[model samples]
Target: MPKNSIQFQKSFSIPEFIQMYGTEMQCRERLFHLRWKNGYVCPDCGSKSYCELKSRPLYQ
Candidate 1:
């Protein structure tokens, strides 16, 4: 790390973060996975869901 460089620190609780920014489901999903870590079943419908979202960014 450089002395002149700055690093931003996260200053919010998990729940607060979810509420502050994120799609409705995004936060819940993240929390669900974090809590479970090992594995977790769907709360709404007892179905197994993927932990990660399938996405790819095209950088210029």
Candidate 2:
């Protein structure tokens, strides 16, 4: 049989994970990209212009 598809996935140790996503900013940036692979867009008006909210995790 062929190798399992999961075998091709990248593996990381705890230290590696921490190095890549240990900070809040890093986590947020990763999430933002994952959520919007094509960059951010306004949900209300479909505009690309937006201001990142400082008090909360949102775009306005």
At residue 52, candidate 2 shows an lDDT of 77
What shift in Å separates residue 47 of candidate 2 from its native position after superposition? 0.8
| Residue 14 shift from truth in candidate 1, angstroms | 14
Report the CA-based lDDT of candidate 2 relative to the real structure.
Answer: 0.87
Each prediction's whole-model lDDT (CA):
0.61, 0.87
lDDT of 1 by residue, 1-60 (tens): 555433455578888876755685676667666777877666667666645545742111
What pairs collide in candidate 1? none
Poorest lDDT segment (10 consecutive residues) of candidate 2: 49-58
Distance from true position, residue 30, model 1, in Å?
Answer: 0.3
Superposed model 1: Cα runs more than 4 Å off? 1-21, 41-60
Each prediction's TM-score against the native?
0.33, 0.67
